[model samples]
Target: MFKVIFRVTTEVRNTAGLREIKRAGFIPFMAKREGEEEVYEALYKSNDLEELREAITEAAYFLNKVNRKGGNNFATIYKVNDNYVGKGLGGLLGASLGLKLGGIPGLFIGAIGGLLLGEILDVELNETFVGVYSWPISIEQ
Candidate 1:
């Protein structure tokens, strides 16, 4: 499996934005913080690393597009699990998840499920068995 981590800053609380992400098709693993502004840790998972990367890139693109249209500001950092290597399946799983969700929260939830499913299937826990992706959004002070 492959994991990516990222941090994103937005113009306002992302409750509705997150919901929109979900509607786009990704899964949200966790969310926290509060008040006028907030931050969240999101995850996206896939059986393939390349796919995961593509998905994350897509999410970032979408978020930026949304922010640009609304005149919001955002930033993100994506890191892949260096320890994890690819299998014969390539990075299709991860890529598929990212393509489907198009956002952080959805990616996180999908990753969790993918991880669980991989375990249940007895997929080998190679260095890349797990992937981690995060997004932290904050309102401009």
Candidate 2:
């Protein structure tokens, strides 16, 4: 399976937009809101790009139909190589363990060893696509 990272800005706020994203097969993991600007980060899992596209299209349609007035402004999608996250997590864990087992020196040594092991174990060739929105949702009512 492949993982996709989707980011979008829309007038739809909070739980409302989250529901639509979930319906599109994306799990909303992170979100940031600054005044009127809301950016959402989500992860979508699919067998291939085609399937992911279909799901995205469906999401767009749903958003357009529901919001109508406040539609998507900008959207981006990327195929993610999730190994880096694992590597970082592993390194932190290793560093903590090392510190407990030894001390400051052990922390550095363990972190390096853990990071290397994480990199070796997690490698992926994922493509990235930017601004693939074919039909931008209307922001005007």
Candidate 3:
């Protein structure tokens, strides 16, 4: 599991511009405010950085194309990681729930599921990156 933070300017905020990003198989995990800019984090499950890079390239290309064709869009990306506490706490909660519901088998299944969820949450909590491109264009209506 790898994390990628796609930072774009809030000057052009619209979900329609994200079509290309979603088409590229990136999952929008969270969004935050950084001073006067808006930042968005996305998740990607790739075997390595090379694979993630290819998808990111394609996504950037798509965004550029959209912008050239009268769309107000610009974005930059970065790689990030998940924290430890999220993984541990998620597993603990899952195990507790499983134990209350069933026996050992339930505990195992619950722990695994919880751990995965927790790892994802950790990524959302620990994303920090500087945006490369910032566009202040307006959407063509």
The C-alpha RMSD of each candidate to the native structure, in angstroms, is 13.1, 6.6, 6.3
Q: Which candidate is the best by TM-score?
A: 2
Off by over 4 Å in 2: 1-13, 68-73, 82-131, 136-141
lDDT by residue (68-115, candidate 1, tens digit) is 121122223233342323321233464468558766665656565655
Error of 3 at 95 (Å): 6.5
Residue 105, candidate 2: C-alpha displacement in angstroms: 25
Please give me the total number of clashing residue pairs in predicted model 2.
0
lDDT of 2: 0.62
lDDT leader: 3
On lDDT, the stronger of 2 and 3 is 3
TM-score of each: 0.39, 0.55, 0.51
* Deviation (Å) of 117 in candidate 3: 5.1
Question: lDDT of each model, Cα atoms only?
Answer: 0.44, 0.62, 0.64
- The backbone clash count of each candidate, in order, is 20, 0, 0
lDDT of 3: 0.64
